[model samples]
Target: MYWWSAVGDYYWSYYRDACERSLLYLDVLRRRGEDYREQSAKAAPHVLSFDFVVLVDGRMLPRPVNYGLLRIIPPPEVETDPGKRPFIVFDPRAGHGPGIGGMKHDSEIGVALGAGHPCYFVGFLPQPVAGQTIEDVCRAEAYFVRFVADRHREADGKPALIGNCQAGWQILMMAAMEPELAGPILVAGTPLSYWAGVRGIYPMRYLGGLLGGGWLTWLMGDIGNGIFDGAWLISNFESNNPANTLWKKPYNVYANVDTEAKRFLDFEKWWGNPILLDAGEMRFIVDELFIGNRLAAAKIATHDGERIDLRKVKSPIIVFCSFGDDITPPQQALDWILDLYEDVDAIVANGQTIIYSLHQNIGHLGIFVSARVATKEHAEFVFNIDLVDVMPSGLYEIILTRADGAEANPQLISGDYIAKLEPRTLDDIRALGGNDAADERRFETAARVSEINRELYRAFLQPWVKALVDPAMAEFLRQLHPNRVMFRVFSDSNPLMAPVAKAAETIRGDRHPVEAVNPFLALEKMASTSIVVNLEIFAKAREAVTEAIFLDVYGSPLLQAVVGVGSSQPRAARASRGDIDLEAAHAQALADMTRGGFIEAGMRALLYVLASGGADERQFNALEALRNAVPEAARPPLSKIREIIRRQAELLRADETKAVAAIAEILPEDSGRRAEILSAIYRVVSGDGEPDAGEMEKFREISRLFLGKASPAELHDRQEA
Candidate 1:
C-alpha cells in the first residue's frame, strides 16, 4: 500500500515538484551568491572611506571596519528643545559580518536618528587580530562608549547603548567593568545567565551536556588549525529551526526566485562572510560561558584577574528578550536576575535597577532587525528611558500598551507610546526556571567532568593533533567548509558565473513584488510552523531520555570523584564580600521623590484618600476635598503624603476592624458611605507593605467599589454636566 501510494498521481507530482524546486533553488543561490560578490566588490571603496580604529591589539588589520552616525533632530526641526540624547547601536559579531544594524534606514539606527537622538554604531574587523581576547573587545567597546559620552555630555541627555545579541552581553560587561561609561543599556536578545532555562524545552542549552563538554569547540578550533570558524556557530543557530534552515528559507527564495534575488543576496552577503576567532577566545567562551555558566555566577575573571560581576554594574539594565528566540530564550535572558539576587529587596539594597519586557513571538535576530520592532519596542524604550531611570531600584516587568488618550506622544509621537510599569517579585521570575537545585547540581557536576576531560584530551591527544595539522591542510579545510561553499562557488574564479551576473543585473531592473500577508502563503507558513513545533517536541523528548540515562550512569559519586568533582573553586568564593551600600542612592531617590513641593503633596494626599479611606476615611476624605478646593500648584508635597499613607497603613495593620470603626465615628456620613469608605481603606492597606498577587487582587476589588461602574449614558451625562 505504501509503495503504491508513493507512485500514485498526487504523491508523484508533489515529490517531483519538490525535487525540481530544490534543483532550481541551488541554481538561484549560485547566481545570487555571484551577484552578491560583485555588488560587495563595487561597494568596497565606499565602505573603506570611514575612519577606522583598532583596539585590543593596538594595530590596524588588512580590512578597515567602518561605521556611520546619524544625529538626533534639530530644534527648528521640532517644536521642543530637542532633548538631546545619544544613541549607540552595537552590531552583533556573530558568524555574519557587519552592517545588520544599519543596513537600511528603517533599522535600529534609523529609528534612533529619526527620534532626534545622536546615533553611533560599533562594527568590527573582518578578521580578529591574533592573541586578542573578549576582555580586549569589551575594553574597545568601553572606549567607544566613552568617546560618545564625551560628545553628548556637553549636550543634555545621556547615551542609550543598544546591543544586539553578542554585543548585548559584551556591552553589559563593559558597563560592569567601567560603570560610568554608558547609560540606559538595552540588551536585545542577549543571554546573560547562559544556563538558566527550562529543561527539555530549551534543548540548545543541552548541547554541551550531550556532547560531554567543550571538547567539540576545542576540536573545531584544532581542526581549523588554531582559528575557529564562526560559521559553525551560525549553523547551530540556523539548525534549531529545521523548517527555516532546511526548507522555508530556501523554499521562499525559490517560490519567488526572480523577485527575491536581491533581498536573499543582501542577507547572504552578510551571512556568508563568517568571522574568525582565536583558539583561546573560543575555549574561553565554551568553558566560561556555554558550559561553565559563570558570568551570572560571578566567577568569570579577566586575564588581568579582574572579576566580571554583573551585579557590580550600577546602571539600570533593560533586558529585551522574546519567546520566539530559541538561541537566547527568555529563560536565559531573564534567569540572571535569580542567579544574582536572592530577592527583589536585594536588588533594591544593592542600588541596582532592572526592567525587562518580553515579546510574544519575535525571533532572535528579529528582536533587533525587524522594522516593526525598531518602531514599536525600540522607539518606546528610547523615548521613555528617563522614566525608567527615575523608577526605584528593583525588578520590574514593563507592561507595554497603547496610550489611548491625549497624554500619548507627549514627546516623540502623535499617538501614545504608552507603557505601564509594574513591579515584579523574585518568585515571579523564578517561575520561568521550572527546575530545582538538584537539576542544577547535576549540571554543576557535569561541568567538573568537562574540565577533567578537556585537561586530559589536551595532554594526551593535542600533541599528536597539532603535529598532524599543516597550514596547507588548514587552508584547504576552511575553503571546503560548508559555509564557505557559496564564496568558493560564486568567486570570480568560478567559470560558470560571468554570464549569470549580467543576467541578474537585467532581472533586478525588471522586478515583481507581492504582499507579505498573502492568505495562501501565510496558511502554508502556519502549517509549516506546526510541523516544526511537533518535530521540536519529539527532539526534546529524545534528548531528555538520553540525558537521563547518561546522568544515571555517570552521575554516581565514585564516577564523579574520578572525573574530578569539586575540583574548581566554588563560584561564590570569587565574589567580594561587602554590605550593600545604598546610602548615597537612597538619599538621591528620596530627594527626587520629595521634589515638586505642594503639587506632589496634593497628589500623595489624593493617593492616601484612594488608599486609606477605610481606616482613616474622614481625615483622608477631608484632605482630598481640601486638595480639590486648592489651586493645583498649591497642593501638598507627594513625598510627605505617601509617608502619611504608609503611617496610616501601618496603624491599620495594628488593628484593622477597630481602625475602620474609629474612622466611621470620625466621618459624618451615611451607613452606605461609611461602608464604601471602609472598603477603600481595606484595599489600600492590603497593597501597602509589599507587592504580591493577593494584595493586587484585593486592591483591584476595592478600586472597583470606590471608582464605581460607569454606564455609557452616565459617562456622557457627566461629560455634559
Candidate 2:
C-alpha cells in the first residue's frame, strides 16, 4: 500500500511540474523578447549597475570610433579619494555589448570604488562609426587614458588599468606601444601569447586552421556589408559547450523557475546584445592577432613603424587566470612571458615586475563576473595594489589564503583573505608546459595556409559577395542567424507566443512547488547530470578529432612546402628583449651604496628580511600602517621608495654579505633613530607570526650593525625576555 502511495505521489508531482514549467518557460521567452525590444531602442546599451558620464566620445575623435571613456558616478555612501590613483576598467567586446566590468555592484568597478579610488570605465556603442579601425580605437583609448591622468595630476601615481578578456590584449598592446601612458595594469583571462597552448587541450586554437583561417573572417565581414556581426563570435562560445548552452541552462531554470528568471534575464541582456565591428577591424584581429600571433612576438607596429614591444611597458603587470578557463587557459595568459623573455633574469633586466595568480577552477567569464572571485582574488589585488606597484622587478606568483581571524594581526588585512607574493623563476612558467617543435611547425603551416586562402578569397570571391550583399540583406541575414532568431522568434512579437504571458500569470497565481525529496525531482537531477556528462564526452571527442585532423593535414611535408613553411626559410623571430647587463646593474648598486637616509635603510632592511617570515599580507599592512603614521610632507614618494628598494635588492643580490654589513653606513648617524628603525623592522616582521630562525638571525645581524656595542644575541634575547 505504501509503495503504491509513493508511486502515485511521484507521478502526480511530475505531471504538475511539467505543466507549470511549460507555462513559465513560455513566459521567460516572452520576457526575453521584450528585453531585446527594449535594449534595441537604446543609443548606447550597457549592463553596468552604476551610472557614468561620458568624458570623451570616440565618435567625436579626429579618427572617429564607437568606443567611449566614461567617468563612473559612485553611490552616495561611496566617497572616492581623489588623492589615490584612479581605476579604469575595460570590458571585453569579443562579441557581446560593453559594461561587463561594472555589470554588478560587487564587480571590478565596485571593488575599486569601495576602496575609495576614483573609477572610470571604457565602453562602446552597438554600432561602429564608419571606417573605424582598431588603430583608431586604440588611439581613442590612449587619449582617454591621458585625459584621466591629466585630471588626477595631484594623485600620487597614474591610473591603474583593469582589462577583462578581449580588453586585456588591447590594453596590453596600448601600454606596450605607449608605455608612459599606462600605470600598473591587471589583465584577467586575457590571451597574449595566442599560439602558446598544450596540444590536445585548447582545441579552440585549432579553429582557425580547420576553418582555413582568416578567409572566413573576411567572408563574414564582406557578407555583412562591410561590417561583421559579433553574434558569430558568440555562437562559437556557445558551440564550445553544447550541453550547457542547449540543455543544462534552460533545464536549471525550468527546475527552479521562481528564482532563476531574474538572474537569467539580467545575463541575457548583455549576452544577447551583440555589437558590430568594421571589416577592417575584424580582419586585423584575425589576421594579425588570432592567426598571425604577432603581438607577443613584438612584430606588431604602428603606422609610423614604431614596434610594440612588451618589454617597453614599465608599469607593474598583474595577470589573473584560472586552470578551468578552457577558452583563455593559463598557457595563453602567461606564456607571453616565455615568448618575450628567455628567462627570469631577462624579465628583471627589463625592470619588469610581472605577478600572476592562478585560481584552481573558475571559468573564463567567471574570472571577471564571479562574485566569489570579486570578493577574494580581485579584492586582494585592489586593496594591496600599492604593494604590487612598488614591488621590486622580478617574476612572482600571487597566492591567496583564507584569513581565519586567528593571525598575529588579523585587523591589518582588510579582506577575508591574505594575499602573498613569492618569487618565481622561468622554470616555474615552463613547468606549465606547451607545444613541442613539431607542433609549432604545424601551426606555422596553418598560418601560411591562412594567408594563401585569404588572398585567394580576396581575388576571386570578394567582389561578387560585395555586389550581392547590400546593407539591407546583411541586416536581414544577421537577424536570421541562429543566435538572434531564437530571441526574436520566441519574443512577444510572435503571434504564437502572445498568449504565453497571460497563461503564465494565471499559473503563477496558484502554483504549488514540488518537494525536494520528490522521487521525480531526484530523477530529473540524475538525468541532467547524465546529459552533462555525455555532452562533455562529446565535446572532448570532437576536440580530439579536430586536433588530429589539424595535425595530420598541417604536418604534411608537401603542404608545408606549398604553404612556404620549409626548413630553410625559417620563421621570423623578434629581436631579443633580454639584453641586460648584470655586472653594470651590480656596479650601479654598489656605487649608490650610501645614498639615502633612514627611509631607504629601513625599507631595504625590511625587504631583505621579510621573505624569511614569508612576506605575507600582514607585513605589508604593517608597512603601509607605518607609512601612514608619518606626516604627509615627511613621507617619501612611492617612486623614491621603489627606487631605493630596487637598488638595495640589486646590491643584496650581487653580494649579500657586503650589503648586510653596509647597513651601518646607510643608517642615520643618530643612535636614537637607529633604535627606532630596529623597532619598526621588528613590528613589521612580527605582524603575521613568531619570527622564524632565518628571520631572527637577520634581525640580530641588523641589530649588531645598528648598535655595535650591544651583542646581537644579548639584544635579541633581552627583547624576547
Highest TM-score model number: 2
Q: Ten-residue segment with the worst summed lDDT in candidate 2?
A: 710-719
Q: What is the lDDT of candidate 1?
A: 0.62
Please give, for residues 1-721, the per-residue lDDT of candidate 1 as tens digits.
6856644644445444444444445557775566545544542211211233332222332221222232333224322223465777787877667668766556776666666676666776555667777787777777677777776565444577888898898888888899866667889999887766775556677678777788778878788788888888788887667657776677678766755766776677667666677777789888998788898788877778888888877677899999888789998998877778877767756657798999999998889878788888887777666555544456777766665554312332222455555678888887766445545655676677788779888999887888888878876887677767866685545877556555555544653333454444466568777876776666567667866755564456676566555433243322442456556544444434423332332233223344312222222333344445558566443333434444333334334444333332334235444343433343333222222455345444433333434232332343234
List candidate 1 stretches off by more than 4 Å: 1-27, 35-83, 405-416, 470-472, 490-492, 496-558, 564-577, 581-721
| Count of steric clashes across candidates, in order | 11, 0
**C-alpha TM-score for every candidate:** 0.72, 0.95
Displacement of the residue 455 alpha carbon in candidate 2, Å:
1.2
Clashing pairs in 2: none
Local distance difference test, per candidate? 0.62, 0.85
Candidate 1 displacement at residue 678 in angstroms: 27
* Candidate 2 C-alpha error for residue 30, in Å: 1.2
Predictions: Cα RMSD each: 9.8, 2.4
